[model samples]
Target chain A: MANDKVTLAHGAGGKVSQELMEQVILPAYGNPVLNTLHDGALVEMKGEVAFTTDSYVVQPLFFAGGNIGKLAVCGTVNDLSMTGAIPRYLSVGMIIEEGFPIKDLQTIVSTMKKMADEAGVVIATGDTKVVEKGKADGIFINTAGIGDKIPGTHISPENVKPGMKVILSGYIGDHAAAIMAGRHNINLPASVQTDCAPLNKMTKAMLEAVPDIAVMRDPTRGGVAAVLNEIAEASKCGILIDEDEIPIHAEVQGVCDMLGFDPLYLANEGKCVAFVPAESADKVLKAMRTSPYGQEARVIGEVTAEAPGTVGLRTGIGGIRVVDMPLGNIVPRIC
Target chain B: MANDKVTLAHGAGGKVSQELMEQVILPAYGNPVLNTLHDGALVEMKGEVAFTTDSYVVQPLFFAGGNIGKLAVCGTVNDLSMTGAIPRYLSVGMIIEEGFPIKDLQTIVSTMKKMADEAGVVIATGDTKVVEKGKADGIFINTAGIGDKIPGTHISPENVKPGMKVILSGYIGDHAAAIMAGRHNINLPASVQTDCAPLNKMTKAMLEAVPDIAVMRDPTRGGVAAVLNEIAEASKCGILIDEDEIPIHAEVQGVCDMLGFDPLYLANEGKCVAFVPAESADKVLKAMRTSPYGQEARVIGEVTAEAPGTVGLRTGIGGIRVVDMPLGNIVPRIC
Candidate 1:
């Protein structure tokens, strides 16, 4: 327990592991359900619920604006929120490499606790594993979340139809650019920071106001381009967007251009693209703008019957170009 | 799509990841909930439920009796079952090293699917990430399970009382011995196999007959000694175990003897120790012995009021020895 670095014995599920939980982890995430110290946590749930999982392997555990722990919590919470569910419980699984600093682990876990508290969710259960130093990266976290589905709400791509509006919440490429900057030691502008914040409150309010939204997705790894393409394919419709309507911070745009990257295909941790019926677009946008995380909400596109399952961009120069799903790893480990 | 081995692109949330899911994972785990391909799965539930998670970093991905995939599924399932819950939905999060064989991945997924089907649970949702080669071990699986708790069942250490009988489902040390055999290349008799099996059905049946079972704990990492010590500490009572009654496979005993390891402190993947009122012990034993996994069920000890917060073993030679929670990693990444 006195060791400053993690040791394999700390994950052997023995006295050392128990001590670590009691001394470090439990203090950060202790609750009635977790305090039982049973193999599993017993909880109560009613009606329908949402379940989701994500593994955060973002390199540079400490990144601009947030760390892997923060992303792990927000990513899964956002996934549940995208389904019109009230985020409730989450289980964390950590695989730490031997010799990793215990202090760093504490910092990461504290970040997760803070993020979970802000999202109105509890760390209900967890597991920890330690591998030899070289067998794993510094640390990887896998979080699975359960949320209560809102009544009278059904969010699915099947509901998308022609004349639906596509709204992008806030700027794009910030998360990707920020991670890239840290990983490659790029001197990015100070404003280029990870937009890694939980969007449950914002999305919950939007869904409450407009329960008929067709689809909701966080633009994470493959970013906005991939989400739109997926929505188009799932809804069996075409999407046409105006390039000028897309919001990209100048710093992020500069970084993307420097790396020959398209901001549309860069990841954003705290943003969502929602497909809403044309009639409800204005109301949903207004609701989104009221939230700090969605202040830059913009109606960037609309669904179309022509060219079903494809996405087209109307360039500011009056030219049309097809936007395809991201193909390869333009930016790896971007969360 | 033509790639024979996994690459970083497969974890990039781009075209490759989608192809891998569609061509490899989806077909195996495609259920109504997962087929939706939304960020999270929507499931219906009412009343109390059990939630648990475990990360499997077992070395020697494939062992004599099972592989990491089997352990991953059964470990979480058994954790939920220990709470007297009927295992239902599971979420799998896999982190794979780049260049890992696609065929191996398929084999693992297939094993998971088969185990899930046998447990009568659905692979509800999952996430996949591929780290750069060497950044991770071959692969590590994190599974979080949700189960519906049985009504009228109150299983906890606090319920343990004097005169309560302690029953163990089967032999100990098989899982740890099997992993150690593979890791150290120790030749072992063919009878030495990992006792990796799901105990949900058997447990559900047993609980039906004995609704007031005091505690149920799977003797996994740190083994029976650790579990008993924890229960004693939690309930603020003393536990006395008849060392002679503890079951150990002959081959496993040989391996442990040679390695100077105690079977009582070695892990068992599919075995559990239950505390039940003396009146229900016989009925529970009969119920457990009826199941395939619990054929070796035996009454190994009883709860006592003396020496609170400690565990004592009555040796066969008429001496008593204190058994403590494991201190260090006798075996690392065993399960």
Candidate 2:
């Protein structure tokens, strides 16, 4: 507390470490379960549960709409949500570099608390470690989460059928565009902020409306193109998407065009691609559109038995082009 | 597979990333739960669960007895064990720097699987992120675990009372001394390696023998001294330990003496400090001794009603001294 910058002692598991937990961390995310200060937290869990983990290493720390802290929480939360689980608890493990500003650390921790609260999950248990300066970046956070599975839903690629409809939750490329703008000092319109929000509520509503929805995935690092390719390969089905139906913000489109980037391959933090049965597509779309994060939800594609294990895009020019799985380093550290 | 060292593409969540998973990670830790390759793993869970998280940033990556990977798994398992739980599932999150050797990564992942198997836990889910060369050290691992609570046992500081016996599992300070020797290029005896082993089996046996064990703690990072101080403060009781009764490997003691470090304050990745009722002390000690990791288990102290919130050490020469909670950076990145 005496130093503005974190020192190695703060993670030595001694007096200083205890002080950091009591003064800095506990005040922000403290709850009955975490306040026990035991080796771990004991919580009640019943039935089947979804488990997931993600490490956030985005550069610049802060972005247009959210910081790395927000991503840390939402990423795992969305992963569980994609499994048709109601996310419940999260464990935060932070690796901080010595000499890092404590103020920034506070901001990050507070943001994590805010996002966890918004997602209706508890910050149940955590650990902190500090590496010597330069040995690590400012800070890297890993969040692992658990959620209860929705009873009647089975979310898996094997459930994908030839007549299934593929839906996009909202616009794409906003998150990656925002990160690129910050890195390159490019000015962008206000509407082009990162679309990094907790999609649990939206996905839960959709599942409640149509429990038989086959598969759901958040197109994150490799974007929609990569997600579709994986699903196609795993389910041994073909996917054909209409380029015109895909939504992209105008400023994001302009930036992607100028930078020679593909909107379909750019990362998105808060969007989901769901494969639903043809008969329930309209109902699921209506459910998604009711949430603020998924207001632009639309049917963008369909699954087919032809050319199984491949994805094709029907461009506006009336020619079909294969959308291969993204390869090489299109954009590093987008998450 | 063509690259000998990791590149940014290996973490871009695309073709290369999938290749890394299929070729490297899956071969080491693959199981039905993890093979689903969904956003998260859906696993069965029932009753109460213990959840914990830890990030391992140990330097040198490889030490005498274990590497960071082994520690990553063992550390979380031990935390769950200390909470009186049967660790069942673990999630691994890795942050690797570009240019790190693929061979080294394979070694680490394999080691994690080995440890997880030994501890009777599954690597249920995981995530990987890569940073630029200078932005991170070789690699850091964060492991979060969930374990089912052992029936009929309540391990908490609140269970501590006057006249309770404190049982310690095995010799202390080997882990820290081995790390120090590696860092300073000191030649340690072959017998003095890092004592970083999973303690779940030993703890499970002890709980089965004596379910009323008051408190359980692994003396890591801040060592036995820090654990005792915390227990004393939390339970509002005083602890008194005899210096001569504490077990310390001769070579580890020599290393500590030469380096001006106190064995009691040095870390032990495998050892545990347990507070037990006087009547159950012998049964718990016998249970610990049956396990190879806890063969040198012994009673080192007793809880007292006098001088609450303090720990005292009785010297061999007939004097007592207050053992203050460790302050400042005693040893950094020892894990």
Candidate 3:
């Protein structure tokens, strides 16, 4: 506890490890189930549950809106929500580099607790391992979550069909731009912050309003382009989008243009693209707009019967161009 | 796919990411639930369930008997089993250092699948991320598991009371000895390999044969000494063990003695310590001995009313010595 930086002993599963758990971790995320300190947490669960896991290795650790801790929690929460489940429990596995600041760890953990509280999930169980200095970056977090599946809802790429409306919850490339700016020391407008927020509430509301929604995916790493291409291939349907309708913050657009980065392939941490039946598009969009995270939700595209298994973009000049799945790393560790 | 080494593109959430999933991961872990390829996997659950997570950063990814991948899966499964649960599902999250061999990745993943199959659990969901070279160790694996709690069993340290017998599943410290030997380039007998096998079946048998088992804990990170100390504190009872009765392989004992290590403080990947009523201890031990993983099961100690919240070791020299909780790193990354 006296040391400001983590040491190998802190992860040696000895007295120091217990001190870290009791002092640093338990205070932030302890609940009755987790406080038991059993090898695993015991909780009552029934029916169907959705399970998901994600590892956060985002660089800079902190960016405009959130840190790796917040992303770790929200990313798993959104993944469960996208599966039509109410996010419930999460397990955190942290790999910390020796000599890393304990203060930074505390900040990250507190941020994680805040996000977990907002997403209505408990940090049920966790483990931490510290690697020798230089063997790892600052810190990498892996979060696995369990959520109760919403009844009467079937959300999957298999449900995606021709004629379904494609909804973009908000602007793209903000997360990537924020991270790039931080890494390159490029000054940006105050408005060009990372769009990192939990989308569980918004997605839950949309699902409640329309349980028959085909599919919902948070375009995090490969951006919307990858999501669209996967859906198209899985559903055996073509996806066509209007370039004018795909929302991009003006500053974010400028950053992308300046860097020769295609916004379509850039990551967005807090956005989701939902495929809804034509009849339910308006209702689902309205439901999404009711939440702050989705206030800018728009119908950016539609599933098409032609050109099955491909995505196309209708440009401003009234010409259509193929939108390819991102081929390689545009930006590594963007989240 | 053409690259022999994993690149940043594999974790870019783009086409290469998909290829990694379909070509490498899916082929190894494909199941009905995981094949859905949604944001999460939907699994059926009923009643009380146990959830746990552990991150494996073991050095020398491959050690005697198993590699980190096998350790990743078996560790979680054993944790769930130690909670008197029937392990069912696991979520794997991997962080690979850039330039890590794809062949090694494939070998590790296939070993994971093999171990999961042996444990009768499914790899339900997973995530992968790649960091720049030198930013991470060769690879780190995080596994989170879910299991159904065995009905009518109250496995908790609080249930551990005075007069309860302490049962150790098998010989201690083989795992640590093997790892230490590998790291220090010390030769070891072939029989002194890591005892990193899934203990679900063995524990399940014990629990079924004796439903009133008080507590169960796998002596993983901090080894049996830490486990006993924690149990003593949590149960508010003193634990007294006979050092002569504690089982340790001859070669492992020699290695520990030569290296100034105590087998009591050495880690075990596939061992558990259980607390049970005196009347049930024999039956539980009998059940444990029926499994290959627990062939050396022994009643090495007992709970005592005197010196509550402490552990005492009765040495062969006719003197009782206090067994302190491990205070520092004995072996780093020994998982």
Candidate 4:
């Protein structure tokens, strides 16, 4: 098993690499779409479509709760979900450093396959290249997904209304904390893991519960603040988020406090903020709560017309502060 | 126009980028596949298929002979052709750095669109992302391709026979020489450019003229020596290349001579090698000579029963030398 750890042969596309994919990665996440095992997946859906692409250069390929592989798939699927489409296919391209262990590659690929299968998406096509050892940090993955647009669903930031309520799908900062914890080898694990998961199913349930959701965004890179700021800028409306209303897991919050980090600025993968008419915000959140990924759904903010392009947060202490877009990298390269 | 020299904005998928693609790329080489402008092209054909993917990370996005965009398309298409397939569709992904000028991106994308069109392949799908200044050097392109296997064209190294002759599609090292020439800024009123172009049309012609061609390959990355050595190893047969019969343009030969780079290991974009029955080799060469990309086609080698897995070269001095597979990177990071 010691020999099963990272090996240069894994990047060689030879037997060692094959074992890693077939044994570790695929078994955990294999499905019909992911099983095709083709270069790029082929998807057959009948409808006008929306397409989205993303690249994951997350450092520390294997993080706390999950690895870069799962992040790549979740990020891409979430992008399509935001557009009200059912993502069906994906293209994966990996740039690996030559000396990278075959075992690590196998793990990453198997994870990708498994995640794609779970999300009902396929890894239709893939390309792999080995760069000289020093050219790349380890392995970087780039993926593009295509989804069939829902027949009549349209959700855009421009649709946010003054009376709309902002819905947080689940706990925040779990993924970021988990990754940081793993990277730094933080001791004493007490069930603190990354919340990396596919949001497509959650989006589907929310839309089915109430199809009139105004805006849906996964707070990944810049977290809740970046997404909220963008929605405000686009809708020309102000946002008021209650600090206590946002859901943060106890472990994640504890880690954030210990590290002097703001949980609001940390990344969340299996989470999203949905703006809905005040009348049906409860209905949407109720439906989200029933989904596995959104059990912690809560109302974090409300849309307002008082101050345009600004997101104001009511402090837990009855004070207020502005939530701004992230300036520099946080948890640098945390997918 | 001086303004048209090069700018990073040209590849942004925005207005100026569109302009560059429309003007330089489309105008130079426009066709049905290139016009669709999808992220990954939709290709339909009836037959078993072979697909391949490649990424171009050539430094100095624009080199002496061609740019990253051209290399991306050519590399994928060439792989498709080598497998005896009709390359019909291609997907492109570009990772461009922020602050790159609008003009440069345009030049690159336009070149890509045009070259794909000329290759008779469509640019089906594309994705673009901007990395911060230091993340990426300038621009990196990734291309994936699909093609229908040509009927009756079962070419493979496994089919090479004792009496088969090898044909060179054109002169060697022109492309590498062109890049070197451009990089050094050598003053030559009559400077030679890279032989960068689509080889599909020429490949199609060869298949039509002689469907029984045993093997076909493009000496692009590791060059002709690499390809030949691979075929020899795969087929478990010896190969004898006639140095005098190999084609080399005067300018290309001059550059290679000065640089001490052998033509056999030099990269070629618009060229290929075909191993066929001695009887069909001449006819195949004639067919190759008719296509724009194959005007310099000629027979340069033959399969032999002696010394399996070894490739020998007959020198101009009447001596024989074993041609081993390239040990190190040849044309490092070309495509």
Ranked by lDDT, the better of candidates 1 and 2 is: 2
* lDDT tens digits by residue: candidate 2, B13-67: 9999999999999999999999998889888877898999999999879989889
Report the lDDT tens digits of candidate 2 across residue range A1-335: 78899999999999999999998999999999999989999989888989999999998789899899999999999999999999999999999999999899899999999999999999999999999989998999999999999999999999999999999998999999999998888999887899999999999999999999999999998999999999999999999999999998889999999888999999999999999999999999999988999889999999999989999999999999999999957889988
TM-score of chain A of 1: 0.99
Interface DockQ per candidate: 0.88, 0.90, 0.90, 0.12
The TM-scores of all predictions, comma-separated, are 0.99, 0.99, 0.99, 0.69
Candidate with maximal lDDT: 2
lDDT of 1 at A305: 99
Q: Where is the poorest 10-residue window by lDDT in model 3 chain A?
A: A29-38
What class would a CAPRI assessor give candidate 4's docking? incorrect
Among all windows of 10 consecutive residues in model 2 chain A, the one with the lowest summed lDDT is A183-192
Model 1 C-alpha lDDT per residue in residues A28-105, reported as the tens digit of each score: 998999888889998888879899999999988998899999999999999999999999999999999999998999
Model 3: DockQ score: 0.90
Over B1-335, each residue of candidate 4 has an lDDT whose tens digit, in order, gives 23433343433233444555566555644666445342222334453555556666665567666787788888788777877787877666666665666567767777877777677777665555544555555666777666677777777678988889988877787777776666566543355666777788888889999999988888775578878887888789999999999887787787777777888887777778889999988789888888878877887878999999999999999999998777544445444
Local accuracy by lDDT, each model: 0.92, 0.94, 0.93, 0.72
Compared with the true structure, what per-residue lDDT tens digits does model 3 show for residues A139-180?
A: 999999999999999998988888899999999999999999
Q: Candidate 2: which pairs clash?
A: none
RMSD of each: 0.9, 0.8, 0.8, 7.2
Isolated chain A TM-score, each model: 0.99, 0.99, 0.99, 0.89
Winner of 1 and 4 under lDDT: 1
Model 3: residue B40 alpha-carbon error in angstroms: 0.5
